[model samples]
Target: MDTVKQSLKEASIFTHSQERPFKCSDCGSNFKRAADLREHERIHTEERPFSCSHCTKTFRTSSNLRQHQRVHTGERPFTCSVCGKGFTQLSSLLKHKVTHTQERPFKCSDCGRGFKSSGELMSHKRFHTAEGLFTCSVCGKGFNRSSHLQTHQRVHRFKSSSNLRKHHRVHTKEKPFPCSVCGKGFTQLSSLLKHKSTHTQERAFQCTDCGTGFESSHELLIHQRVHTGERPFSCSHCTKRFKRLSTLRIHQRVHTGEKPFPCSVCGKGFTQSSSLLRHNVTHTKERPFKCSD
Candidate 1:
């Protein structure tokens, strides 16, 4: 009882001290205590000590890890008070609570972009850095963001040929983005996000100072490299800079002369399957893009 009284007295003294000692160097933000300073340090460091075992993914905090584990365990403890819809995490409930308050605290620093939750900001950051780590094994293509890779992989899973053609158009469009040094084109805003990394020399997707900046933000990352100069996808022995791994494979043929694509009508050899795919249409007199039939 005496110990409790002493602790209470110390707390009262702190409240009266008028001291705000904890200050952040990166954002110039202030905190009331040292512990908060340490916690806030993780934002600048991008260090996530907590990790999930299932997918071998890392999270910044234990609370995020606990929330993620619920997805694996199917534990939906949070429920809507009015609708009774369940979520595996309390954060989900808080997000659902936004429909009631219309509160959006999280926002983008590079742009005036706002999100209802921090997770949304987490997802949104993918566009600024253009870091996509996941890859499609069959095509040997990488993406900066998982959601974009998810969206692209779905194109391959599409059962309809018509849908596939529509999906293919996304790969060959003239979409544009702001130029950090030189204005270039990108298929997704996230690729532009990763491209901005090249001009800023800002590799937020780094492992260390010696670590590289090659995390993927979208599938078909050929559109991402107008920003940075580091070319990771290369032939084991040769020196070549390719924006896409698929292009690097095609370039390797210059050394090997190994033509995988052959024209059906004339039996002519080519280095790329895309070249063959486009050439075959010419031989068949098929302007697939302009077809009225």
Candidate 2:
């Protein structure tokens, strides 16, 4: 009886190990769970059985489909104890925790710029290195990033012929970035800074890798990506590549046709405008309505 019990325990352990029955024919990857295997198979099969009742969106996994359906249901269950706010997904709530902690773990080794999120820091680093990624098929105006390219395309999309003619001057001009060291002018600040680094030879941003330094930490991060080859930013529309997710998002907007920002005064909507500037009499502390001097 004792031998039979031990054999049954061993058999249970073996069964646990052999639970994954599906194998990826293309990659020869084996999954430990059947549900995970199904999800993996859907990648090749393009099978989205689980769907949102609110929208026409579908998902291969039930969890993703459930999250989508919540948006239509207006149900955000994950509430914050600190702010008393709610999030539909736990990941969002975890991101919100960064605000309270005030922690910026991701730092640029080149420029020493800190960001609340990796997303923001990644965007900031792009300014240091001219990663000419976003290209225009219309007039062949190449950009270092796709977000800028998308914003530029809006000019072609909505601008009149005269406006397009006028915008060409901005392209031709040599005044995008000004030098901080010598007050010299250039079309790009990043190039000017790289030049300044030669004069000052200031490798202010030091890498965590080998303590190797550069003029901007973004350059270092971009360099590090070469080692890891982790392209987190993927094209939602296609298999196109990008360094940052925001660049991918702006690119995705090109296909989805979603623009939410609008001007309050002129009713003009822009994807990226400097600000909504309202005229104020700063010289005087006079309010006609309040009767205060």
Top TM-score: which candidate number? 2
Positional deviation of residue 119's Cα in model 2 after best superposition, in angstroms: 1.9
Name the regions of candidate 2 deviating beyond 4 angstroms: 1-22, 109-112, 138-141, 150-293
Q: Evaluate residue 214 in candidate 1 and report its C-alpha lDDT on the 0 to 100 scale.
A: 55
Q: What are the per-model C-alpha RMSD values against the true structure? A: 22.5, 20.0
At residue 12, candidate 1 shows an lDDT of: 91
Instruction: Tell me the tens digit of each residue's lDDT in model 2 across 155-211.
Output: 767458755654564678746566776777665555676768867888988777677
Cα lDDT tens digits, model 1, 1-293, are 99999999998998788777788989988877887788789999998899898877788778889988987988888889978889986766888886556466777898866666565555556557654555876675777544356567775687888657656658777465565678787655666777777776664554333444554534324444554565778776555577676677667656544554546675445667778788777657655676568
Q: Could you tell me which 10 consecutive residues in candidate 2 have the lowest summed lDDT? A: 274-283
Residue 134 miss distance in model 2 (angstroms): 1.3
